[model samples]
Target: MVIEENECILLQHRTDEDNWCIPGGVMEIGETFEETVKRETFEETGLEVNGLELFGIYSGESCFVQ
Candidate 1:
């Protein structure tokens, strides 16, 4: 879910966690799954309601988030 804006890809810098993810995080309890994707993108990269286009959905048990 990387947002290609200008020249740089939108990445998150979490002070308490990983510093570079494509603006996403864990789902809050009872919240919609898409809510996690949308909300996390905003909270991390500070972009909201722009031109978000879905490229793909990723799933795995390994790698960075694992």
Candidate 2:
């Protein structure tokens, strides 16, 4: 999500599910995770990002699977 200087995040409202979520999507073919992040961010929020770093990786049963 694109967080502004005020610490507000860019969230998408899902009409089908009636929920709000951070902008993200599945990784495309031959695309790296960082590339997917950049593309999804732009596609959803119309913003470009740089200087990405490792934050955390979630797995296990509780995590969503594509």
Candidate 3:
């Protein structure tokens, strides 16, 4: 998820892949969704965020592969 403020958003650039994308990663065992978001955002962007709300949850056949 990208944090938006004043119509601007935060993104991370992947030097290995040479692409820009939202900062995120797989959730660790025993970590809540919010905790995962905060940890990934900090790891990728060096920024700390708080007061997060659940945005949306996506899951379906189209989101995965057989």
Point out where model 2 deviates above 4 Å: 1-4, 59-66
lDDT pick, better of 2 and 3: 3
Tens-digit lDDT string for candidate 3 (1-66): 779889998988899999999887777779989998999999989999997878886657765634
The deviation in Å at residue 51 for candidate 3 is 1.9
lDDT score at residue 58, model 1, on the 0-100 scale:
58
Residue 34's lDDT within candidate 1 is 66
User: Could you estimate the TM-score for every candidate?
Assistant: 0.54, 0.66, 0.82
User: What's the true lDDT of residue 8 in model 3?
Assistant: 92
lDDT per residue as tens, model 2, 1-66: 444457776788877889998877766789987898899988877888887765655556776567
Q: Which portions of model 1 show Cα errors greater than 4 Å? A: 28-34, 60-66
RMSD to truth, every model: 3.5, 2.5, 2.7
In candidate 1, what are the lDDT values of residues 12-43, reduced to their tens digit?
Answer: 66678656666666667798666777787777
Worst 10 residues of 1 by lDDT: 57-66
Better of 1 and 2 by lDDT: 2
